[model samples]
Target: MGIILEINGFKYFAPLSSFKPKHKRLCETIDFIKVGIYAVINLNNMFPAPLNLCKAVQIENIKNEHYRNLVRAKYRIIKQKTEQIVNNAKDVYNHKMINDGKSKLSQRCNDFRNLELKCKEYSDKKK
Candidate 1:
């Protein structure tokens, strides 16, 4: 035989075989146990300790789907902003290189590629 207990919107199965004789007798006397168990244990009194930093951080990160979507959207916005900045910098650098005319065409192209690679590296590191 087993008893089903509901607590905090969750159901827990506690078999009679697992309980002591005295506990079984106590449970059997409860009339409303059939409907649903209540106040079998006070969870607030059971734990007075604070969670560790890592556990707190993990719990904090457990967001609902809406919150997760918002964070993802924010990240995309920031990434786009960074990319725009990088593109503008590239344009300005290319203009300056063209005006100076000291570098060969291939060298200017290589420099632009290096600048793009640096921007990508920065974005990756930010992520």
Candidate 2:
């Protein structure tokens, strides 16, 4: 999972999704980032994932060579665009906040503001 630039001081995580047949039909936008033909980083799915709840992946421990290599390659690509990805995520958040499901992307996106409240509540309860 990769993080969005901190929103309200809370980090949000979004996942790289496998390229669907439908993805090929659509164009990449602020909420959708295409990673060549391998995968797409769907900013619409981003949500507040607390740092403590996230564990580091042991890429070296992967038993499948092909899968491991694919992950590594994807990581390198994503790593190179860390700044862009962070900015895109922040943009997605702001877009959703303002759109409030008015836009098609916002309808699919997790309620970022609401998720932040839930994240804070969960953290407070745990503490």
Candidate 3:
């Protein structure tokens, strides 16, 4: 036969056949009293508190091992893309600076401004 305990919506079972040698000897000597005590201890140890504590430890280990690398890679990609956009905007600004005609310089400046605004919008949306 087995004893069952319900805790935190979970059920734990300890079969009489599965007791430790000490518990088995106690069961042989004291019978149901010692068997009941051992079953209570085993069921309490298998309850939600210790199980959730173990799960919390596992989650922390996973965060330390995997999440840091994922975050770094994500930020590195964003930075590279932002740098590319900035370089393009700079090239447009330099072209505008070099031009002598007001009309052409104004057009290049507008292009640079539009590019910068678009990059900002994109980054904002991404965030």
Top-lDDT structure, candidate number = 2
In model 2, what is the error at residue 44, expressed in angstroms? 1.3
Model 1 residue 109 lDDT score: 31
Query: Each model's TM-score, in the order given?
Result: 0.19, 0.87, 0.21
TM-score of 1: 0.19
Q: In candidate 3, residue 124 scores what lDDT? A: 60
- Judged by whole-model lDDT over C-alpha atoms, candidate 3 comes out at 0.35
All models: lDDT? 0.33, 0.81, 0.35
Task: Report the C-alpha lDDT of model 1 over 15-90, residue by residue, as the tens digit.
Answer: 2222233443464221111111212221111111111211212323747877565445434443454444334333
Tell me, what's the RMSD of every candidate?
A: 29.5, 1.8, 31.5
lDDT of 2 by residue, 1-127 (tens): 4534566689777877887899998997888887767788888888887888877778899899999988788777778877777888888888888999898978988988889999999999999
The alpha-carbon deviation from the true structure for residue 55 of candidate 3, after best TM-score superposition, in angstroms, is 40
Q: What is the lDDT for 25 in model 3?
A: 52
Q: Report the Cα lDDT for candidate 1.
A: 0.33
- In model 2, pairs of residues that clash are none
